[model samples]
Target chain A: MIAHKESGERIDPTGIKIGMWLFLYSEIILFGGLFVLYAAYFHRYSESFAAGGEELDRLIGAANTVVLLISSFTVAASITALRLHQRRRCICLLLFSLLCGVIFLVNKYFEWGAKFARDLYPGSETLVGGEPGLNIFFGLYYIITGLHGIHVLIGMVLLTVSLVWVVSGRATAERYSMLDNSGLYWHLVDLIWIFVFPLFYLVL
Target chain B: MSNQSLEQQQQEHLLGYRQLAVVLCLLLLLTVVTVAVSYVDLGFFNVPVALAIACGKVSLVLLFFMHLKYEGAIINISFLSTVLFLVIMIGFTFWDVAFR
Candidate 1:
């Protein structure tokens, strides 16, 4: 390690953070594009969007929100554990966070499965072939939530990798950027869900 | 790499367990409040009110969970600029739609 440092190979946490922030910016922009579309369609079909929102299971949405919130907290606590050099605690917290992600995805699977059962897919007979407004509402719903589910999966993978590193003793307090970065990404996931939850589930 | 610099950095970045717990509680409380509020009919104010609550939740996550509050000016500027650009994109789109 000393040799690597002597050779100018060092971990710069600041640089890592800046890069992460830039990546997060691009992510926000990606989702922002979808928000623009949602705004346009909501303007065009206010009643349809409300109708579509009413069909969503608010209880499930609320449960998912709680799950993600707890996960975000655990991930943050994991980073705090890392800083304190409690590797075991950090790994445990990360595992808990990963479990929350799984629970979230499971809930999503059931939610989407139920929607599919009702023939409420994008081009399905019930939604797309029905009213134009319902078509757009459900279409946007699938695209946005599907994309967010993918992010949740990605965040789980990241936390899992960080957990493995912690177990292997690679992610020490001195070089914990991996863990910190994962926490940031997880927070981004939660942040997006905050908006998505309201736009789809609550703000009818 | 020195012990002193390592210690200094830790001092700067280390967050306490109690603080994190408090923030978590606050977030959970806000979640319940938002959901409860949604059950009412606030007319046009419903969307805006829900969104405002969501924004509050996001701010807490960004500041405490993501540690943006503890970070320096450069990172703050970088992240805020992204929000600015997002606002621009949404604002312009709304402008065009409203006009047309």
Candidate 2:
């Protein structure tokens, strides 16, 4: 029953928090489907999966891991800044997080580009002489990583929008639910990367 | 609206920074452990070890960085349900793929 002095707005923070949680739940399901697909194909092509995974540059993956971990920390700090009502610091941290996301996508671009140059675009194109295991492995690789890259792209856009809100004064310390929710979403993006890094790059 | 200064509010909020730093350090340690353990020829234990470390890191992030520890039970329940549902889906898919 707290009232806003300026516009006389009454807010229920709990409701919005729950709404974000629900949204996150749906996202988990979406990613879960892709994970299942990956697991199925991995089981089918254990050796090829390992071999194809070796083709991936571990250094790049590891660098991206550091990048994302740093971004996650920045986003966490941003949320703390928001709660502390430090508007400038919050905005700066959010911008830094978004920049990190862009760097991740750039890395992904090079990784996928290398695969494409090798004529590894999944499906029949992925197999040179009908190696079923390689075919299956590449197929799952494209599907899972492709979908994940798209999600990261979306997250970048979400973070950019939040940054814009902060710049425009639409998001403030007292009414920063949007920023908080977006931070959660960004953290999830980073978390997914944490799993993806090990699964795709280090498992071999 | 009574009287607390903005600086005081900011300082109070930063009180958790030390705890966050500790968790971050732990996460880094776990990451190193996961990578180092991966090099060992433990057969099936390799993936399990990596996954265990990953789970531990995730727990730290959720409980500390995300402030889930201080949040209401509703948030915890919601997150748990999400994880549970994901497990069920993954299990079903595993069964279908393994048997077929």
Candidate 3:
């Protein structure tokens, strides 16, 4: 939101932010509906879910969690740097955050590759041959993580656009709603992963 | 007006680098704690404990990272209402499953 004193133009920051957050609310509900599905299935197939979670590599999951957390940190910090007119620092932090997102996707690629190698995909014969609940567990796994991966990709694209905007002077300190909103989207991604990690990888 | 001083005047919630770093440390610490806690088998309590920590992390991210802490009442209420509805939906479904 910018207040152009000379032209008497004003943008309400709260209105701008709340508009973005309204969209984020919908995103949360979309994922929340999925979580409810996971809950019901988990309620019925507790053992199968536990077993499926055990098959996952917690180390990789933890590492991704850290990557996302750090990425979020950088994104949030970049906004601060922008506000403070530390343009170089802001750009550097955004580059680092983008790298973190790339690392996350790379890690996910290897993780899913391992799963496919084990024939544990959605309609794999192994799950079809094994306990029915195991199929449900793995099915939910693919759906949730796959959807989240797409969100990560979209977030990276948004981040890239925001980076360019910053570089080109479109998102200055006074007028940075684009960067701020993009950061909000990125944080929502991290927020979802916070729940996903424990639910899918740390099932006890 | 200079952008920097004007921004400082208008945006009270412009988080500093130090504050952002501290929030990151807290989030990382929470992540480690949740993972470490998952190692101990706390039958029946494990999910709850893990979820509790996840909630903590979410709170920090929402408040510090997402700027929800300094936002307006409309946003705060809207978020709370959304979460309430989500809880109701999930709760009702589980309640049905439990009785079945």
Give each prediction's DockQ, rounded to 2 decimals: 0.64, 0.40, 0.65
- Model 3 per-residue lDDT tens digits across residues A147-180: 9999999999999999999999988887788989
Query: Model 3 clash pairs?
Result: none
Task: Name the best candidate (by DockQ).
Answer: 3
In order, the TM-score of chain B in each prediction is 0.86, 0.81, 0.87
Model 2 lDDT per residue over A20-70, tens place: 889888977887787787788778777887887787887888788778777
Q: Kindly indicate the candidate among 1 and 2 with the higher DockQ.
A: 1
Q: Residue A65 of model 1: what lDDT? A: 95
Off by over 4 Å in 3: A5-10, B1-11
Worst 10 residues of 2 chain A by lDDT: A1-10
Determine which window of 10 residues in candidate 3 chain A has minimal summed lDDT: A1-10
Candidates in order, TM-scores: namely: 0.94, 0.88, 0.95
Q: Give candidate 2's total backbone clashes.
A: 0
**Candidate order by lDDT, highest to lowest?**
3, 1, 2
Tens digits of lDDT, candidate 1, A47-89: 9999999989999999999999999999999888887888889
Give the Cα error of residue A60 in candidate 1, in Å: 0.5
